[model samples]
Target: MQLVLEKRAERSGTIALVSPLLAIGLTIVTMVILFAILGKNPLLALHAYFIAPLTDGYSLQEIAVKATPLVMIAIGLSLCYLANAWNIGAEGQFLIGAVAGSWIAVRTQGTDAGAWVLPAMLVLAAAAGALYALIPAICKVKFGASEILTSLMLVYVADLFLDYLVRGPWRDPHGFNFPTTAEFDPVATVPLLIEGGRLHLGSIIALLVVAAAAILLARTIKGFEIRVVGAAPRAARFGGFNANQLIILTFAVSGALAGLAGIIEVAGPVGHLQPGISPGYGFTAIIVAFLGRLNPVGILIAGLFLALTFIGGEQAQIAMKIPLDVTKVFQGILLFYVLACDSLILYRFKLVSSNRQVPRGAG
Candidate 1:
């Protein structure tokens, strides 16, 4: 007996739309089992994870703040994925952006830099991110190196570089020996949407990014090229689209967006660059990208849902003594289910039996 997945003649659009929801449902069921195994009340844990975070105004605001970066980074990642450019190092690009932006912030810590300061930081961060992402793109184009491995490996390098900067030269001299820079000046900070509230301009920027991405994918020739290159590369080439150029372009754009997200997180929320500025936002954006079906609008909704989990994880830890790692487990399970469910869109499983002659040695 043998089992195999057979390709379908046509992909089911219905399944494509429902796949993410199916994955979410499966993830929830798995979480319930996990909670039971951990000796916790499954219903209560579920309530805390989903309902509790939504009921509070403060938690709702915090969720928006968290989603800002996720949506921004995911939007960029969606482009890369669409163009068949595997960029696994958004985390590194993020760190590099924060570090690059902070250079301006650090230098002007106590000085009177003009309004141009914040804009310069943003531009520099985006540029740095693009340049950093180009390393893998160029390597893949020129040397036939795998972008996935090179990009992922560079993440550690960027991480270590950021760590060294904060612990060494970027550290605040007057303050105690903490691995952080001085608080950014007001001119460098992102303006808040509401007085004394966590909501900031970054959220608005994320919304704009979503809208822009929607337009790009739907209305632009470049967008069509990216889609063709990813979906049918040989055909795209026949149509006069250069795959290598698209790869470079997508990587640069993705890196720029991720870098923008990084600087926004530091300037808008943290007010300083530190070691743990990101609580894995770059990595979590991967889930956001897929869960949204790589659509801008979908990514927005998905980002908010994932942001709720971050808040829920904190509440679960504080109220139920649940391990924070459970949230990560939930994400991992969700991703697995997502990939598994998506296979059903284009494939079906079959069981087959071979003739006895195949096992003549046993006879």
Candidate 2:
């Protein structure tokens, strides 16, 4: 029994080191099979999905576009996960932030708010997101509510609220009955970092946030407390770590980053508030955070990789005549392998003898 337990511990450690690589490998293999089932050459599909995106500047830019919000949201999520706080309402926070930021942008039209307008909108977005996140945080702290359910349910509420606004009060009168707001003025737009590239300043902000989060998690007292709180709540409490404060702080930070991502998305690539502005970046970032093992730097790279999948999916649809749902399948497969690999990281499989040992046991 002791030997078996020792072996299992070693196996778990080994799996922790190899799980990420295994997940990636499995994702690739699954995609190959999917392409074959679709009656397309797997090689050609692979090229379209992976290699083709890197062969040109435009496609690379699109990858950045998709990765920007993902990185931002995932960075915040890393913090929440570290504190062992489950904040599943990033989607709602994102939507609310977009709404708030766009409201400021639209209201400031015909005025010379200049550079301050964009900054103000961003601030509003962050605040809106944080406030939205506080609802669940407060409930959890005061009433012992399950944050997962509350946060997730709020996402639908935020989505419906946005839908109502765009279709009702905030509808563009000149949009030909479209469910979108007016085009944002230039003052409300997020500036591009490169003159000829689709990459925007938001990418720079994301990198900065990543660096900041890493530093916070690695070098700060608060970071130590967060780790302690997650690793051993009883010890953390004994050490005087305030659980309520950590919970609120974690949610606030997560919501703020998500809000920032939402507004930047609308002001940058999106350029207007639409009924469905996000392509589920909020939800996808949860996967990114976990796939990265909840590490800030890891989340950054994982976000880029997932962004590649999105770009590749679009390319596969256009070039290979594959359905868009294929991309979702790829994501689903990736998630499955990631979770399976994670399980192996903490558990070991044992093969037991099927045959009865009656003679050996003297039964």
TM-score of each: 0.96, 0.93
Clashing pairs in 2: none
By TM-score, the best candidate is 1
lDDT of 1 by residue, 159-196 (tens): 99999999999998865998999889999999998899
How would you encode candidate 2's per-residue C-alpha lDDT over 1-363 as one tens digit per residue?
Answer: 121211354446667778888999999998888788889999999898889999999989889889989988988887888888999889899999999999988787668777788999999999999999999999999999999999999999999998998898888889999999888889899999788789998988999999999999999999998888987899999999998899999999999999999999999998989878987889889889888888888888889999998999889889878887787777778878898888776666665555545455555
Q: Which stretch of 10 consecutive residues in model 2 shows the poorest summed lDDT?
A: 1-10
lDDT of the structure predicted as candidate 2:
0.88
Model 1 lowest lDDT segment of ten: 354-363
Please report, in order, the local distance difference test score of every candidate based on alpha carbons.
0.93, 0.88
